[model samples]
Target: MNAIDQNAIQTLFTEARTHNVWLDRDVSEQTLRELYHLMHFGPTSMNCQPLRVLFLKSQEAKERLKPALLPGNQEKTMQAPVVAVLGYDTEFYEHLPRMFSHNKEAKSLFEGKPDFINATAFRNSSIQGGYFILAARALGLSAGPMSGFNNAAVDEAFFPDGKVKSNFLCNLGYGDASALFPRQDRFAFDEVCDVL
Candidate 1:
C-alpha cells in the first residue's frame, strides 16, 4: 500500500475509540445483516461459531435491559441506537459434529465433558465478539463494548431458558465526537513485542 493508504489504515486503528455518546440516527437492519455476514467469516478454533447477539432497539426492550446494567453503563446503553447482548451458547459443542468434524465423531469430545464444552464455548464466543467490533467499524458505526453489568441478571431477563449466557454488552451507533475524551496513549511496538 502507498503511504496515504497506510496512514488511512492507522487512522482506522487509532481513531476508532469506544463511544459513549451517539447521534439520533437510525442504523438500518440491512446494515446490521451485512455486518454480521462480514463478521461471521472471522476464524475461530474448529470454526465453532458460538456468539449469539440480541440487538435491543425498541424502547421496551431497552427498558427490559436497563435493570441489569451497571450504574455507569445505563445511560449510554439506553441512549445508543442499539444495545447488543453478546452471548455464548452453553450447548455450542452439540452442533460441532455438523460445524467442525463434518462427521458424527466430534460430538464425543464434548458429549459429557462440561469443562471442555464451557472452555471452547467461551473462548470461541469471545473471538466472535472481537469480530463484532471490527464489523461495526467496517460498517461506519462506532461501538462501546463493556462488561460492567451483571451477567446473571441479563441472562435471566433476556435468556430465561439458560441455554445462552450473556458475555458482554456493546452499544452501537454514530458517535458524538464532541463527547469523546482525548485519545489515550498506547505502548510502542518495542514495549509490547519481543522477537526471539
Candidate 2:
C-alpha cells in the first residue's frame, strides 16, 4: 500500500486536540455504527474485545448520568451530543471459546478465576477504548475522554446487573472551536520515550 498522506495524519493526530466544547448538531445512529465498524478491527490481547459502550444520547439518559459525574465534569458530560459510557464485561471470558480459541477448549483458561477474568477484562477493554477514540476521529468527530465520574455510580445506573463495569467516559460531537482554550504543551520525545 502507498504511504498515508501527511495532511491526513496531521488532521487525525497533531491538529486533533481533545475537544471540550461541542456544537448543537446531532450524531446520527448510522454514523455511530460506522465508527464502531472501523474501530472493531483494532487488535487486542487474544482478541478478547471486551469493551462495552453505552451511548447516552437522549436527554433522559444524560440526566441519569448527571449524579455520577464529578463537579468538574458535569457540564461537559451534559452538553456533548453523546456521552459514551465505556465499560468492560467482567464475564468476557465466558465467550472466549468463540472469540479466542474458536473451540470449546478456551473456556478453561478463565473458568473459575475471578482475578484472571478481571485482569483480562480491564486490559483488553482499555485497548478497545483507545480504538474507539481513534475510530471517532477517523469519522470526523472529536472526543474529550475523562475519568472524573464516579465509576461505581455509573455502573449502578447503567449496568445494575454487575456483569459490566465502567472504565471512563468520552464526550463526542462536532467541537465548538470558538470555546477551546489555547492548546497546551506536550513533553518532547526524549522526555517520554527511549531507544532500545
Candidate 3:
C-alpha cells in the first residue's frame, strides 16, 4: 500500500496538537456532520461501533454539562465551539446482527454476557474516540480530549436512560496556537514498542 501524503500525516499526527484554548470561532453543523462521516469509517471490533457523541453547542447545553466537569476543564469546555460527550452504548450488541453481516449469530454471542459486553464497549469506544480526534484534525479542527470529570454525573446528566455510558469529553474548535505550551516529549519506538 502507498503511504499517505506528508501533509496528511502532518495534519493527523506529526503537527497536530491537543489544543486547550480555542479561537473565538464557530464550528458549523456541516463540518461536524462531515467529521462524523469520516470518523464512522474507523474499524471497530465486530463492527460494534459503540461510540456515541453528544455535541453540546448551545450555551444551555454547555451549562448542563458544567456541573460534571473538573474545575480545570470548566472554562475551556465552556469556551469551545463544541464539546462532544463521547459515550458507549451499553446495549451495542443489539446492532451486531445488522453490522456483522457475515455472521448473523454475532448478536447472540455477546448477549447475556455483561463481562464481554463491558470490555468490548470500553475498548472499542477508546479506539473510536481516537479516530474522532484524528477526524476532527483532518477536517481542520482542533480537539482537547479530557477525562477529568465525574463519569457517573456526566452519565446522569447527558445519558439518563442508562443505555449509554459517558466515556470521555472532547472540546472541539479552531485552536489558538499562542496559548499552547511547549510541546512535550514522546517515547521512542525502542522504548515503547517491540519490533517483532
Candidate 4:
C-alpha cells in the first residue's frame, strides 16, 4: 500500500495546533458521529473500549460543565461549538465478551480485580481519548485537549451514576487562527527515544 501524502501528514501532525479559541461555526452532530466511527478502530488493551464521550452541545450542558473547568479553560470551552467529556467506564469488562471475541473469559479475568480493572480502564480510555483528537483533526476539525479541570465535579455533573469516570476534555470546532501562539518546539528523536 502507498504511504499517505505530505498534506495528510501536515494536517494531522506538523501543522495542527492545540486551539484555545474557536470560530463561530457549529460542529454538526453528523460530524461527531463520523468522528466516532473512525476512531473506534483504534487499538485498545483486551479490546476493552471503555472510553465514553459526552458532547456538550447545548447551553444547558455547557453550563453544567463550566463549573468543572479550570479558570483558564472556562472561556474557550464556553466558546467552542462542542466540548467532549472523555470518560472511562469502570465496568468495561462486562462487554469484553462482545469486544474480545477471541478470548471468551476476558470478562471474568477483570471482574473481581479492582486495581486491575481500574488500571485497564484508565489506560485504554486514555488511548482512545488520544485517538479521538487525531480523528477530529483527520476530519478537518481543530481540537483543544485539556486536563485542567476537576474530574470529580465533571463526573458528578455528567456521569452521576458512578459507572463512568471523567478522563479529559476536548474542545472541538473551527479554530480561530489569531488566537494561536507560535508553534512550540518538541524534543528531537534522540532526546526522547532510545534504541533497544
TM-score of 3: 0.98
lDDT of 2 by residue, 1-196 (tens): 8977988787678888788889999999999999889989999877888899999999899999999999988998799999999999988877787788756666788889999988989988888888899899888999999999898999999999999999999999999988888999999999999999
Flag the better candidate by TM-score, 2 or 4. Answer: 4
Identify the runs in model 1 with alpha carbons over 4 angstroms from their true place.
1-11
For model 3, the stretches where C-alpha displacement exceeds 4 angstroms are none
lDDT for position 37 in model 2: 95
> Tens digit of lDDT per residue, candidate 3, span 1-196?
9999999999999999999899999999999999999999999999999999999999999999999899999999999999999999989999987899899799998889999999999999999999999999999999999999999999999899999999999999999999998999999988989877
Error of 2 at 172 (Å): 0.5
Report the number of backbone clashes for model 1. 0
Q: List the candidate 4 regions with Cα displacement exceeding 4 Å.
A: none
* Residue 5, candidate 1: C-alpha displacement in angstroms: 4.1
Report the number of clashing residue pairs per model: 0, 0, 0, 0
Writing each residue's lDDT as its tens digit, candidate 4 over 59-92 gives 8999999998899999999999999999999999
Checking candidate 1 for backbone clashes, the offending pairs are none
lDDT of each: 0.89, 0.90, 0.95, 0.95
lDDT of 1 at 35: 78
* Local accuracy of candidate 1 as per-residue lDDT tens digits, 56-157: 889899999999898999999999999999999988877787788766677787788988888888888899999899889878899999999999999999
